[model samples]
Target: MKKLKKINFLAFALLVLTTLTSCKVGRFIVYNFADIKDYEKFPARKIETGPTKFHFSTTTKGKVPEELTVKDKKYPFEKYLADHKTVAFMIIQNDTIQYERYWQKYNEASIVPSFSMAKSITSILIGCAIDDKLIKSVNEPITNYIPELKKSGFDKVTIEHVLQMTSGIKFNEGYKNPFGDVATFYYGTNLRKAVSKMTLKVEPGKQFEYVSGNTQLLGMVLAKALKDKTVSSYLEEKIWKPLGMEFDASWSLDRKKDGMEKTFCCVNARARDFAKIGRLYLNKGKWEGKQIVSEDWVTQSTKIDTSNGSAWYYQYQWWLPTKTGDFMAKGILGQYIYVNPKKNLIIVRLGKSKDKVDWPELLANLGQTY
Candidate 1:
């Protein structure tokens, strides 16, 4: 009788857990269980590229330092990658591929989700829109582009405010909560509706809050400003095609066919190709002697803003390093594109989960050595 009762108790607990896992909040986890396990298969919208592919020069010089020291301690590079569940680790120096390695079947051709790194890409698109004169300036009221948001408490918001994540939009960025705004943005359909429902919690540009909704709002503004052109097309023509990315990347959409992209996250591309974005910024928005994005825009976008007071200084959509001048585009689950202009180096790291390695410190240490 005792043994039977114990078995029944165990079964009951599992049944309750399963039921909880199937709820709306839990649905994202259950539905994407397979995708979470296999990142390469994450669904996304195709961002097609043109025929010409940019070729990266290869060199054997400057191998990754066997180990990187952090906080006065040394850790092996290979161990760091393995421990962090790194899928791809790449280093580029002087416009040459210095070191490249792949793990768990991911290689030069494999595409991985960029998570929030797309935020930086979206900011670049905004700069392009400004350069094209589609929008007057970053200071222009975002409502000038998206009139629909005018009455949504976004009347005072500007393009610069959204890029700086100072839109003061009241949004819960918690990923763990199933019913939170972030989960709705990430797993729920209908991004347009999701963003439209957000209300302003404070005055725009008063305080810096890193909210994905800010980027989503910016996307809506871009869509309005571009009119007939899609964000993907603008990116393709202005940056991707010109940069010569080898593979056609994709952005995950809220729905199939015509749904809006989750502009705050989800740019799926190869590690090698993602490195080009860093190199583009490192070269001050010029690609192969052509001014792809204006030098002034790149300067403003990557320049660190100390006013935010965040541990990682916030710039236009990029994260400024603790050290000055060098910057990085970071995403959830250990995705990073670290650029050091002084060293003429770019490091791309993509992983399945948060890595144990402190990349900023590692980069700072590398900055000292290389």
Candidate 2:
């Protein structure tokens, strides 16, 4: 009877494993949490880099301090980053590399998933689409491109509303809940279907609510605007290639075949290329005398604005940490591309987890020293 009980337990365990692997929420349960390495788990479309590469001027004696203090306690700088699960960190100022470091066996070439930083990139793409005339304007109702959402009363929602995360879409942003809306979008194989079923929780343009759904909706709109071109290809053509990224990166998709990009997150790239994104915005969307995106769009994205229920700290998918013209592209797992145009500075940090650090504040403080 003891042996039979053991066999039954084994069978039950197998069943649980099967269940966890088969369903959408179960995939969330299996993965447990998001990670910098998450790109490995998903299928992706490559954002191919151009033959012309842009390299930051490097120096052996970078000005970064070797130690940092927190809550009146001091720790070695590298130790602090490692303790915080950081894998890659870089500092750039005056168009030169100030400091670059790696931990956890990660290096310059290691790919780190951008997490929500992709939101900022999505915002850039939207701006580019507008500039290219593929998109009429942000004021236009998103229903112009995605009319299917009209059935859900999304006709009143503007692209600007989604860009500001004030769309009032009924979305659960909690990552801890396996059955939540974000989990379904993050782990489910059908992003288009998931987005199509989205309904409004409240009227759009009423309040500021930070949710990933808004960005995904923007992705859908972009897909429709681009028509035959995939969003990834558009990104490659417009940003990646023009930026002269040193390495090829990819945007993770929801499935392996004709899959929609998980544009609410998941841009997998190296530290340098990620830094270039910051550089782009730092120069007001210009790259090497070429206008990659309009300076007006960059101003609109990073400037302080609180109108129409929009939060002052966020606009056009970029976080304005302070009113001093500083902005950042932040990800869930401690990933960041912090840009301070006032100081001509950019800091890139990628980690397995945030480790409870107020990174924007830290990076901003670091900027003051430069």
**Model 2, residue 148: C-alpha shift (Å):** 1.1
Tens digit of per-residue lDDT, candidate 2, span 180-229: 99988899989889988999989989899999999999999999999999
Give me candidate 2's TM-score against the actual structure: 0.94
Output the number of the TM-score-best candidate.
2
Reference-based TM-score of each model = 0.89, 0.94
lDDT of 1 by residue, 1-370 (tens): 9999999999998997677543445556666522423333334566777788887789767576788676888889778677778889888888888889988888899878888889999989988888899889988998888777788867788888888888888999987777888888877767787877888988887888898998998898898899988887788788888898999988777766577777898888899889999999999989889988889999987776556432247789998776568888988777899988888989998888765667666765676576
**lDDT assessment of candidate 1:** 0.81
Candidate 1 structure, TM-score to reference: 0.89
The residue pairs found clashing in candidate 2 are none
